[model samples]
Target: MTEPQRLSRRLIEQVGCSRREAELYIEGGWVTVAGEVVDVPQFMVQDQPVALLEGAKAEAPEPVTLILHQGAQVDDRSALASITPASQAAEFDTGKRVLKGHFRRLQCLAPLQPGASGLQVFSQDWRTTRKLTVEFNKLEQEYLVEVTGTMRDGGLERLKRGITHKGVELPRVKCSWQNETHLRFALKAPEAGVFAQLCAAVGLTPLSMRRLRLGGVSMGKLPAGQWRYVTAQERF
Candidate 1:
C-alpha cells in the first residue's frame, strides 16, 4: 500500500504540474479523489485514483461579491451570519462555485439602518470596496418607504426641491408616491436618520423603509434571508 500524501503533491507528481498549479486545480473544484470532488489541496490521499475534471484550468480564483436580502428584523451581524452555504439562494444562476474562501474577509458596504431591510453588499474584492467607499456619494440609492399621515400639498415637490433640517440645507432627492401609502426615494449618499427627518418635515410618519437598488444593481426576485453572487455582468 502506498503511503498517504498531500493531494497537491500527488497532483504535481501525477500531471507534472507545478505545486501552485496543483493547488489551484484542487481549490477550483477541478480535482476528484476516488471519484469524489475534494477542494482542499492539503487533503491526504493514498492508493486512490485522483483525476482532474474535464476543462479544469489552473487560473487563480476570482474574488467574489455577494448581495443579500437582509430581513427587516435581522441586524447586520445576523444578516452576515445567514450567508452560509445553506443560505445561498436556490434561484442563484451564476455559474460561480461556492467556496469557503468566498466568505472570508468580506466587507459589508452600505449596511441598512435598524428595522430596515433589502439589498446589502458584501465583497471580498477591493475594486468593489473602492467603488462603494470612495465613490459612495456618486451612487444613487433607491428606497420604498411606507408611511402614515397625510403629506401637505406640494410636499413631494418640496422634498425634490430639497429641504432644510437643523438649519442646514439637505441635498436634493427625487421623491414620489409609489402608491397611496408608499413613497419612493432616490437619494444620493443620504445620512442616517435623514429619511425619518425628511418624512417628518413633510408631515408624514415613516412606518418602514426598504432599499431596492443601489447604483446599477437591483434586488430583483432575491428572497429574504438568502444571498447570491454578484455576476460579472452586474456593474454594482
Candidate 2:
C-alpha cells in the first residue's frame, strides 16, 4: 500500500491552489478528507480525493469559448483580458458563470489586428485551440473590408490573383463590393492584416477590416466591445 502524502501538497496539486492557499483552506476548515474535516496542513491524506466545503470554491464549470466584437480603438488583448459587467455590450451578457479555472488558462485563436473586429475566439478547451491552429489553412475567413480611393481598372481582377509577400505566395481570394465602400472578401488567411496588403496591391487604401465570419461561425450582430459565450450548437 502507498503511504499518505501531506494534505497541503494534495490540495495544492488537485485544487490548483498555491501552498499558501492550501494552508488557508486547512486552517479555515474549508477542506475535507474521507468525509471528515482535516484542518492540519501537514495531515497525511490517504489515496482519496479531497472535497471543498459546501459554498466554498465549487467545481470548475464547463469550458467555454467567447466571441468579442472589438472596435478600431480597442486593443484585442486588452479587450478579452479584462471583461466586466459594466464593460459588456449588447442587449444581453454572456450567460456563462465565470469560474476560477476559466481565468487560469486561456488559449487564443485567430489573432485580430488592432482595428479588426468580430468573431475572434478565446477558448479553454485545448481541442478547440488545436482545431483552429492546426486546421486553420483549411478554414475560410470572411471579412467586410472598407477602403478609400477609386478601384483602378482591372484592380479587382488583380486583387483576386493575390500577391507574393516575403517570398511566400498568398492565394487568390473572392472579392465583391458590398455597396460603394464595403467589399466582402472570402479567403484563407495565414496572418493578420492580410486585407490591407491585398487592398494596397490593387490601388485601394484600406480604411478598416471587420471579420464577419470564421469557418461555420458568424459574428451575427454581436455588439462592439461586448462578448458572448460560443454555444455548443455552434461549430468552429
Instruction: Report the number of the highest-lDDT candidate.
Output: 1
lDDT of 1 by residue, 1-236 (tens): 99999999999999999999999999888899999888889899999999999999997678899999998888777778789989998988666777777887888897675678899999989999999999888889998899999998889888989888677677688988999999999988878877888888879999999899999999888998889998889996
Off by over 4 Å in 2: 1-60, 85-104, 161-170
Q: What is the TM-score of each candidate against the true structure?
A: 0.89, 0.65
Q: List the pairs of residues colliding in candidate 2.
A: none
The segments of candidate 1 whose C-alpha lies over 4 angstroms from its true place after superposition are: 1-4, 46-48, 73-75, 165-168
Task: Rate residue 29 of model 1 by lDDT.
Answer: 81
Q: After superposition, how far is residue 97 of candidate 2 from its true place, in Å?
A: 4.6
Q: How many residue pairs clash in each candidate?
A: 0, 0
Candidate 2 lDDT over 138-164, as tens digits, reads: 888888988898887887777688766
**lDDT at position 105, candidate 2:** 65
